[model samples]
Target: MDDLTCDVAIIGAGTAGLAAERSARSNGATTLLIDETFGGTTCASVGCMPSKLLIAAADAAYGVRHAAVFGIGATATIDGAAVMRRVRNERDKFVAGVEDSIAKIPDAVKICARAKFTGATTLELSDGRTVHAKAVVIATGSAPMIPETFDAVKDRVLTNETIFDLATLPGSVGVIGAGPLGLELAQALVRLGVETMVFDKGNAVAALKDSHVADALHAILEKELPVVLGVETQVVPDGDGVRLSWSGESSGERHFEYLLVATGRPPRLEGLGLETTGLALDDHGTPTYTRETMQCGDAPVFLAGDADHDRPVLHEASSEGTIAGRNAASFPDVTAAERMVPFSIMFTEPNVAVIGVVPEDGAADVVVGTASYTDQGRAKVMACNAGLVRFYADAADGCLTGATMAGPGVEHSAHLIAWAIQSGWTATETLALPFYHPTFEEGLKPALLAICHAVHAKPPPFRDDGFLPGT
Candidate 1:
């Protein structure tokens, strides 16, 4: 009800907003953090943690059912209700942690209400309170994208926002969009004994850029559940379920009790009243912002997290929030340069990972180094040898630039590759690092060696000799 003034005003109390708030405060700015709801975004509530819990449960069920590979005869049964209950229970703990963090922030500085921009440096709270600030950060985050075509079956359609809330698993599920979320959830659903299928307009699965890696993932996921790609899908109500028809001709239509639209997430920029800021909006309606500084424009306004739609992962969001917050607090005085290399991981069976600069297949400046689980001793022994890892390096300098892989332990490999790339490690130098025998990391050696060869880096005599047992 009163007019308040602060050095910085941070809209949205999600992960990015929280980070920005702390960073701005740490930088000696009187910061006010506002949000209609507390806790973080998709990661805590329904996105990352809950989905991973479901995936883990599904993986355990799959492993037990297929235990005959090691000559163990055991019948595994899954309780759909129990599995979902456990997922939600664990998911709540994470959500509680986020709330606890928000609780620790002084109440005097945090406002639980929708904030609308009244001016470039002013926010009007829904409760009639006005905030006149020197700088502002926008971190409103994003929401699931539901296509207009699915309006016929809107009641049956679910997104990550609602899927985890299911009290019981659907008898059948049709996941529309074979991106990371769709593919991972489809495989988990299949393992949980719920008949599942995935459809995506894009030819690629799990957002993989590398054709070879994408092909491998498509094949592997197809083995678990039907993956329909490169076709438009239509959903119509059929009794209590929904019947799906695609662009291509088919004799029959498939029906599912539930439909998951995991196509993508669009920024939540509807009600914030952006017209007051005079900041340019991108083609996607996202505020035009710089990657290096996170500044919306020449003004002391910033955008971070899913709001920016750049590298929407949690860690990247945090980094961007810190940058935005620090810069907002010190506008026109300091702007930090972006130095972190890009990194992303999809936690599916034999996780999918992309790190650094993904080069084109036949790029003249980059060389491709590839290795398959079929040749890796550890993967073969584990009976999970079904994927590939490919690394891209600067051909002229042999510096490791990027890596894309769909294989066991790829999450760890992705981290290592991202670190090496960020640290400017050459392929030869990475190959020289110790790789123990009969380990998944040993698989990386071959790829790095291939890159060294492509770059014409002469290796030491021991590596050249047939002395290596695995080689």
Candidate 2:
């Protein structure tokens, strides 16, 4: 077998893997990244980039067909094929760009030829070769989940993997989950005139945010893609179309024509050399990381991306990968034992974004503020009545601790809140900061105001911080 070596080796070339490689290089360290596909998920194929691109196209077509909503009396027809072509072209350009970028990295970052571990410090390539590295980072991104319960016939059923390849919209689609993937695809399909139904076993889609914010999202999405919010769906063979069985409770059980499973992801550690390392993996089959610093304990191995903990998002994975790569370059991360990691979430339509924590989650005190969409300076011009911005403060010092938002233009507000929380600002200071008006950003007002108005009000007694906790 051929033998190889590198200072640091990364198992995936997705966003996280690439980020690690880039970060490692900047730190003047040698690194290597390996994956079956160059761009991994979002940048290349079926992750956020391509999905959002198609959704944007569908939204554009919808706007064209429904111009009356904007007070412009006009009639327009949609050409799905033309819009799809634009989406494909744009997606291709992005994937190509991602590949071209990673290729440009210097020799310090040597990409392996698809290697899996045969030993603790050694790996076997696809072509009967061997390699060794001082350290290894698992950035292997997740694949679209296709549970075995569903019929596996290629044409009749599809996973998130095959959905993007669809030539034309189906008459109806029963998406099998309510999370980001399912809802995103379901919404896009409906916008393109496909009768789409988003089915989920539970309310896991955008479930991490406040229930009030989720209600707002539900209302907006109900206007288009009908959500089977409280259903426990099971897939079976149904001749031309698949059959999905789910308890509708009051509605009993329901079936569907097409099925798209966007349930969750399994780590890509099977063929790779996890057996060679002594890392911790659960029965659910996820690699565990040291909570303090993301290290895999004694071994020179670290886990990032979906393989790290199944929170499958491009941005989070990439951020983790960069950290892993940086730590790998510096031998091992002994310093990060005290550093805290941040969490980020993204969504469609008034995008549900949250950062920091409520008093219930941690610490002794809490502060909150809010700004609503209807009262924004530009709400009149936009004719919008949706969106809320919330901020949390530590009761002891009145310092900003966390923030969350739902509405248009909250993208900028997420950054503002993140900075305020990380910078240790107080409610009074944040309120005094210059905030532009007539935008969804107006939502940030209420949470900060709450911090000031509600002095002794502590957060709930319990802290159920799922994804991120502000300490």
Candidate 3:
């Protein structure tokens, strides 16, 4: 067997792996990045980038069809084959870019073969190669979950992994699971003129913790497409497509030309041979790793990205990768710091987003500030007023804790809140920042004002003039 050595060995060359590799190398570690395939990931290949492309096309179609509200009547026709072609063409460019970046990394430090652990610090490749490293970082990503019950009808099931490869859109689709992936593609497909029905075992879509925000998003999505929530779905083969039967919130039977499964993604650990490391496995068959340092026990092994199942968003993956890489390079002396304020966004219509710490139920120290886009100036002008924004703050000090919004331009608002929370700014500090009028941001003013009022319930400190500077 061929032998190789490195200061840090990173498995998987996706976003998280790349970040870890780069960070390790920058820290003066001799890094070896390994992956069976290095072309793209769920993000570049099918998850975020390609999915957004499809969404953009669908949005255009939706905009044109809604132009009648602006007194401009026009017919918009969408060709399924053409839309898929455009999506593939654009998606290929992104994949090509990732491939090109991988190519730039010298082959001497990159291995293009499947690998598993032969020992705690040794790895065996599918080819007759072995790598010995001081530390290892498992950045292996995740795959879409396909239930075994759908095995007979697997040919008709479309996942994020295979949805972008479709030559043409199906006549109708039934989406299982109302998470980000399901709601996003379902809405896009519906807007593109495909009959779509979404089913979820839970009452919430997009995993919104705030009940009001969840209700608002559900209502908005229902106006565009049919959504069945709090239902368990059973699928079976029916001719060319599949038949679905679900019950809980409602009982229903439906047949679709295609079925898309968007259930949870478990950590991918099939062939990695984690037993070799002697690290304890979690109940989910994933390695026990700390989110703070991404370390897997005391074995000098780190896990990042979807493999860790901590925070699977693109930015969070990058951040975790950086920490894992740096810590892996440092080995037994690795150090980790507090994570940044958590942030996430789902790019649906009237985008859903959250930032900072979300308060739990019956939290007496929490105060909620609210606004509705239904009468917001910019939203009314854009004719897309169909959601709400809510901010949560510590009532004791007006410190912004978290926020969840289901309204137009929430993506931008989420960024603003993230920065404020990350910087430890309170509600009053954020509100002091200038907000332009007739803009979507101005809609946030009411919420901020409400928070300021709630936190300042007692007499104003300035009112005690005896101790004031002027007095």
lDDT, model 2, position 275: 69
TM-score of 2: 0.86
- For model 1, residues 1-471, the per-residue Cα lDDT tens digits are 679899999998888999999999999999999998786666899788999999999999999998999999988788999999999999999999998999889999999889999888999998999999999999999999998999999999999999999998889999999888888898899999999988877888987889999998888878888898888887789999999987753324688999999999888889898988898988887788788999887888999998888788999889888999999999877576755899889988889999888887788989999988865778878888888899998889899989998898888877888889999999877766667777788878778888888888965445641325433
Q: What would the per-residue lDDT of candidate 3 be over residues 1-471, giving only the tens digit for each residue? A: 669999999999988999999989988899999999786866889889989999999999999999999999988899999999999999999999988888888788899899899888899998888999999999999988898988989999999989889999889999998998899999999999999999988998898888888998999999989899998888888888899999998998988989989997777778899887899998888989888899998888999999988688998889999999999988888797689888888999989888877788658999998988887778888998778889998889888889998888888888998899888878778877777767888777777778878887432333221221211
Q: Which residue pairs come into collision in candidate 3?
A: none
RMSD of each: 1.6, 6.1, 4.6
Better of 2 and 3 by lDDT: 3
Give the best candidate by TM-score.
1
lDDT of 2: 0.67
State the weakest 10-residue window (summed lDDT) of model 3.
Answer: 462-471
lDDT of 2 by residue, 1-471 (tens): 546677788788878788877777687766666666465455467776678887787767667766777878765465666766776777778877876887787654555567787765577777676668887777777666676677454356667667666665677788877876677777787878777788776753555555556666777778777676776666666677776666764244445567777877677777786766766777866566764445777678777877765446666776677777777777654437433325465646656676766444434566556566755556545555576666667677667777667777665668777777777777766667765544555456556666765664333234121211111
lDDT of each: 0.87, 0.67, 0.87
Best-to-worst order by TM-score is 1, 3, 2
| Candidate 2 backbone overlaps, count | 14
